[model samples]
Target: PGFDPAARPPAPPPAAAPPTAVEPEVTGGGSRLPLLLGGIALVLVAALVGVGWILLKQGGGAAAAGTGVLIVGGSPTGAKVVVNGTPAGELPYVDSSALVGSYEVRVEADGYEPYTQRVVVAPGETAKVTVALKPAAKATAKVLVVSEPLDAKVLLDGEVVKEGGPAPWQASDVEAGKEHEIVVQKPGYRDARFVWTPEPGEEKTFTARLAPALVRLRVESEPAGATVYLDGAKRGRTPLDLEQVDATKQHRLEIDGGRCYERWSSTLIFDERAERTVRATLERSPACATRGDRAPGKKRSSGTAPAPRPKRRGKGKLMLNMRGAWANVWIDGKDTGKQTPLINYELPAGTHRIELKLPDGRSTQLTVEIQPNETVKKTVPAP
Candidate 1:
């Protein structure tokens, strides 16, 4: 190398021509500087996106692993189950991905009681609820009875169960069923009977009032003197004072006078009541007693010709009770214009004709002698 400060080095040999500038591939006469810059920016963005995806994948994996499964089962297989107050199908419920926490579990079913409990579910752990339901109790429903006047006897279905019992008496533990007869009795009191039915465990009450005993009867006649016979027993003469007689009976009376009077038979009605009277009028016989025979009201001769007796006629009552039969009543061939159940009818004591006629040309007839004051009751059934 020769030192040359002389003349500034002969133009440095055209200073090695600068490397020829290479023209980049171009469109519309634009250089590729902008494309190069954009390529660099795209590479940076792709790197950032790859990093974000890796982070998201890690987070999702952590979340998926955090929660746990829940399994529920009960003693009674078909019981209904609810988890955290939300319906969870039947007793055997499986929730594959339940969040880890405490859950309220409830199991219920008909014919049995309900079961509820709280369960803890740790991560990746299975929780179960088992319940044995209890059975329900049986049902029942009761009857009570009360009577006035403390110390009285009470009978049920012909069985005497209570004597000198409580005023407001109660018969507990009795079977529940259909109607049963009940009777109450005390000395000198009328018998009281009733029927009652009760449901199971039900309470019913009955109250009764006591009654008195004994009834009186008086006898009288048109003719002053006539023997009185009550229920086939002989009492004193007619116009008699009140006599103690059975309240539930009928009395038959027979009258006979010497020659001119006719024998008479009559009946008396003695109902269950306080007081009643029996009256009868003697009639003279058509053949024996006559105005001429009496001899102008002169007393009969004392001679043994038993004084002329008088014929006596009496009246009786007829009571007809019919069931399921529609028929008109006829007496002595005369239309009474009455139907069945004819009550308290009066007829001559002598022979009488009675008939029942149906709407259809069918009839039933009977003839019989009736006694005075007697009640003759008869019933005709349906045809």
Candidate 2:
């Protein structure tokens, strides 16, 4: 009951406190806390330097006082800006903190020419560089042609480019740096054809001063005194020399040899400075060449009353027994809307173009003329 009074022999003198870890004193009063703090400060300074270097490399930085500025602008915004061969930033950029020096500024954009300039930046001042980019030229050539006469037709590479237009003609999107042929033609003038190559991005022009292409056409017939009609216009009689005829186009001539005219129709083509010869024999084939006999045949009557005369018709008759495979007929460049087997078809009194077009894209052109009350039959074979 009295155990707490003595406390059990004082716990064996508290075990002498384990000598309290007596450390050896440093001679220079060195402490690890200061060294550890210095190491942490050095790492922080290095990290800050690295971040500043990265910021400078990306084309901008917080500059000190008295530093120069660089201001760049381009004609079109959004151009890539490059300074001293290093990509800086987009155009219309302002670098407020840059060292004073001469910088090679370059601006580049799509579909435009690159612009470059050397800018001198002064200390404590801003250097402005304004550039206007040039638009790239297309590779296709543009050509303009002017002719003397306004009624001229323009043709390129044997194909008709302009049949009817105003005075001056323009051809765009022509292939550049290649041999192109130009042809200018008129009804009464000689056609001019020339081959030329257009330089890349060059504006080309050509003046087609055409000359007259005239020729003489000589007409002769076995039976003299045959009247000739050139292109529905009445010319002189046969055995005549016709001058000033155009040599470029084909001409149609109608020969009427008086009574037995037979509606003779033919085509003639004249060459430059050359004479054309036409030889025809006057004969009656369809009686279209002549105004038929005026007298009408009458039938005899047994009674006292005289026989009445048969009335003569003014309209002409064309009996065409034309037949071909995949054939077509055209009159004056107009489709007849009928194909093949034109059996005894009636046509008006004039020269008609009977064309037979085959499936092979080959066409046979025939000129026919039928007289009043005259029936003409022709069997055109396949060509």
Candidate 3:
């Protein structure tokens, strides 16, 4: 009855312990899944709060640096807008990003009185301006100037009126109750000036009578018949009378009496409507006796002097009728002692020089051939 260690018939393998169900471990709070999820949610909330704070700070900074807006609108659209003396743009102007400041605004248009105002702009705020324009008053006073000489220039208050054209000129917009100077001018004539004050709505007419600016120049040399020159142009023989010389200007007068006499020169000036006489005494040069030229008034016998033509023997009639103005008549360099409208005046049957002299020192000349016993008619034009 001894027990063998390998024998004992594997005593029933100790009942193969029953399979047991595993139970989850429990903390005092709850499962660990819920705590882990709660921790993650807290982390997410903190991140969201940090992002919101950063966004708020950035938005506040942006608001501090914002600009103002300036908008201008008005009647009379398309009118010019000026800000602080600088041209901004047309009316209905808008500046969205304008620096906030005080500005002087002005609006101007044709035929309208200017509108001006001052405005202040604040940051992030709009400054709005509205302008209503008023029309300018029309001038009712006028001045009419008529000049005696057509095409004369007219000047008012030192400014040319009716520029680029003639006078019979009219000036509108003349201020009432104000004295204005009117000047009418033309070349070769004296200027006419007038001062007048016009009444409101009054159209006053002024007449300007201009006078001729001419001088009567008579030049004579000692031994007459010497050549005379005025301002470098030949004016004929000495004892010359020039009626159309310009007044108030210096004129160069030169007298050359052949090669036998010394030349003389002088400067002459005359006033308007003045009669001036220039007398020059020429000296004979010693070479006059030694010159080999022909003697004075003695013609060289060149084939008997070509036999002078016979003068006509019969008389002829001449009638002169002047138009517009009367002038003194001269026949053959002799004064006729009569004005124009000479009917059937008797003259020699030959070519005669007829001169008409006006009162204003203006003259014209004509040559007429008279036929024997026939009347010659001539119409003299006004000077």
**Ordered list by lDDT, greatest first:** 3, 2, 1
- Is candidate 1 or 3 superior in lDDT? 3
Q: Flag the better candidate by lDDT, 2 or 3.
A: 3
lDDT per residue for candidate 2 within 20-93, as digits (tens), equals 78789887767789989999999999998887666445433432324688999867889999998989999788
Task: State the displacement of the C-alpha of residue 367, model 3, in Å, after optimal TM-score superposition.
Answer: 40
For model 1, where is the 10-residue window of minimal lDDT? 56-65
Q: Model 1, which residues run further than 4 Å from truth?
A: 1-151, 159-174, 197-213, 248-272, 281-284, 287-383
Instruction: Specify the poorest-scoring 10-residue window by lDDT in model 3.
Output: 56-65
Query: How does model 3 fare in lDDT?
Result: 0.75
- List the candidates' TM-scores in order: 0.36, 0.42, 0.34
- For candidate 2, the clash count comes to 1
Which candidate's TM-score is highest?
2
Q: Name the candidate, 1 or 2, with the larger TM-score value.
A: 2
TM-score of 2: 0.42
Computed on alpha carbons, the lDDT of every model, listed in order, comes to: 0.64, 0.70, 0.75
